[model samples]
Target: MLIQKSGHIIVNNSTNIYEEGSIFIYWEGFIYGFNQQSGKKTIREFFKNLQIHGFCSAISKLHGSFVLVLANEEKQEILVASDASGQMPIYKNQDMISSSLIELTERTDLNKEDLSLDKAVEFVLTGFQFGPKVLFDAIEQIPPSKIVSVKKRNFFLINRDKEDDPFLRTVKHDSISEYLNQWEILANAIRKEKVSIDLTGGTDSRILVAILNHLGCSFETAISGQPTHPDVIISSEIAKHLNSHEHFTSIHKVDEDTLISDLYEIAKNSKGINDFVGMHRLFQLHKERAKRGISLALGGGAGELYKDAKQWRCALLSCNSKNRLVDKLVNTGFVGWGMGSQTPDQLFQTEIREKSANYKKDTKKFLKDIFPEYHKCDVFRLADEIFYKYIIAAPRGFSPLMFPHYSPLLDAAFVHYGINLPKHLRFGHQFYREIIAVLDTKQEIASLPTTRLGMTLLPKRIIPEVLTSVFLNLQKRKTTISLNDPNLYSLLRKRLKRSNILKELVGIGLLNPKIAIDNIPNKNLGRLVSLWLFLRILDKRKN
Candidate 1:
């Protein structure tokens, strides 16, 4: 990594005291830093132990998705910690550790002049980059279940064995009552706070509504994006059936003219690889929350960690045969190996293809490191990587900046409960429905079909011929609201021509000028444009 910035570790600053009492200890995410109970644990008692035991200890013992920062005046040092799932990332520059990766931009020099080879390959194939590696190489991301310390000119890590608690070495199943007990405990915390939910027709939020209702809490709900979306219609009905106030449902339409400029700006700042059109509109909803004084909202985040789609990804990876892996990838139209397909592997250039192919070994190794217990369960492990990378990591970037949201499933108690529980019940949301059924609250969540599958929670695969016809019809609708809008491709082509990235890639022999722009679609165009924007935005050091 290039260390070109002059940032001294301040050992002590008497002036750093009391701004908010002239001191600022910046930490984000929901923290259960205290463990007060009949154990008679005081918040001070908790901190005293935390200062001695290290940062991640609180999370292991208390369990929630949070980032904790502990600054010790006595030690003249700072400890930064992220939760077990690494839900909130902490970025480190030569000088400081921060929650935001944008901090790295202030440095004039970077460790890498181009994208990391492994990341480039992975992003092109998978639509997102690997963890602990941001869009920039100079800025390093501190992985989850870690405590990092910066003292004077010294930097180091404080690793605890308890960080591995969520990955529980042995597989065991917790009962339905246990899961509900955990949910009930979490729900009780904000029962008096008038909780607000982005209630959807989906199981995650619906289950949350059921729990909050059973607790007799004051709760309201909202939905955003298309008014006609099944989630919107279903969620509105759910709120009515529960007899709770409906907060709002955003029906704001986006302007196509904005995609060429403002959309790129949003994508760049978001620093996400896979998020396309509707996901980016989370920015607009942020403003809505602030106007409504909705301080805390709830959503179902890690629900997919055990869903059928997740299991499917696992089952494919667990094939343990390269030919089978390649065959599955080809059949699903996911990895276009071109085994007689019209434009097999034509999406990315040959060099990119080869680079991606080579990284599969490294990628498999990476997954193993994250999940060492998954000898026969690589599927669950791989699904977890997807959940963590896209579901938890990408979206949480919007929060601590936009609005704060939580999922009960993300809590450490719930995570441990589900992971240890029978695998079959967890992902299909069969267990989720069981909890609601037991709650004796509204039956809507249990009886209603999810907006995601349109048919219900567990959807049956339609015949390929019928599916193809339906997809083609949907594909023809041509919604301009997409980041993948064909018109945006023209804009991206122009943007590429003006940018120095392609020339730089050519200089590095990473680009083949002849085939760089061949057979690209709106999604591919969007990814390329976003990558180009990342290079520019990071290069220009734009905040």
Candidate 2:
């Protein structure tokens, strides 16, 4: 077995190995190590039994995030498997397989444009790029809980979730106990590493804090931005409460010109990635922690999968009983199809918007497939599927190069209860709060401000609201680097005109080139800037 990697593959012998044998594995996840002999004993056990049971049984029996590829040299066959709920993306075309979609596309022989114009427009409209049909049309991605086998020029899907998998056993008088137990189970999975939790006031990270606090695990926290930033202040309080010291790294401000230039470079290098803007700050935070000698960062990413992150979209797409799916999409907060339709029809310098004009039909079909049992099921479950695909697009595509990041929320055990638990109990994290109430009793789960939902002040709503308002104001003092900024917004518009994006926009005519910069505000500007940066990337990739 010969081992090869582009940066994405884990390089340490502890988790990385290439052998010249029939069974080949690219395992990227937490696995327990034995002091006795085998470095990755947990991975060893799974690999030991994988061939005997085949991919499905062995994969299902294991826990944590990973992709295992088994190749049979003698039979000229190969099996690729991943966690039931996905993490890393696996891209394959009969001749080769890799984790990076851009790398694969570059290496392929297909006569493809650097970026698929139709897909780029679709992504701009929908904030989504599907794996099977992606930014590069000819490539494909492996979704979670799946097995794809290649042999004799034939392909097979070996492990798809049965309907019963979603409705796991997760209801009882002590539902809180069940969830608490699961949390401990997940926390214990991290073994022999310098652990650090990327602390935020958000419920997701707080959940990890709860587990760590409960287990008496000694760890540090890394908080970015300044003390007045709500995340910083609230997380400082949390750190004090947990008795774990946190490193506060102030983000040095950069001017708009520098920021835009950086954004262009980032999009080009990251290959038009999602879920991050200005990764400089994120890495700055991590670098601060690294100086303190902390590695293996943990996040609450993907915890939203269990909550109704997109209840409105779920209802519209799932129920489909509504007459104006396109209208709702055009109006709502959907990063994609949402506001594009609302843009005035006269702005086209050419023909961009028209390329994805029939996107409504595609949107409805995609939504229908994802939410077939929408009416009958818990909205959280539907939201879970949505978050699984889009939101995690950040972590799935980006986490490999960031740090040894772990999301316990994606664990099968953690998600199992989240999925099967009674929908009502799951709402507002009633079950999550109950566990905190039972354990810490005064953890203030309700008072904590959430990024997804705005800050909620419980007990004394008015008083906390006043304090939160003050904190927000102080934080906003430095929030001027925004598309909403009159100056910055103008700069972005001018920059867009100089780029080839408007030319491409004219070709597709999906977006009106004539629309004034004033019409696109802060949120839209972020997307617009992202699209502008994307066009630069597209130009680079195409050439």
TM for every model, in the order presented, reads: 0.74, 0.75
Off by over 4 Å in 1: 1-25, 33-56, 62-65, 93-95, 169-173, 191-196, 264-278, 312-353, 357-362, 365-396, 440-442, 452-519
| lDDT, model 2, position 209 | 79
Residues 275-352 of candidate 1 have per-residue lDDT tens digits of 333244565665577687765667777666544443345344656643343334344433321112222234445666
Instruction: Please report the candidate that would top TM-score against the real structure.
Output: 2
TM-score for candidate 2: 0.75
lDDT of 2 by residue, 240-311 (tens): 667554545445344556766656544543423442343435645665666766647777866655543444
Candidate 2 lowest-lDDT run of ten? 1-10
List, in order, the clash count of every candidate structure. 14, 22
User: Per-model C-alpha lDDT, please?
Assistant: 0.53, 0.54
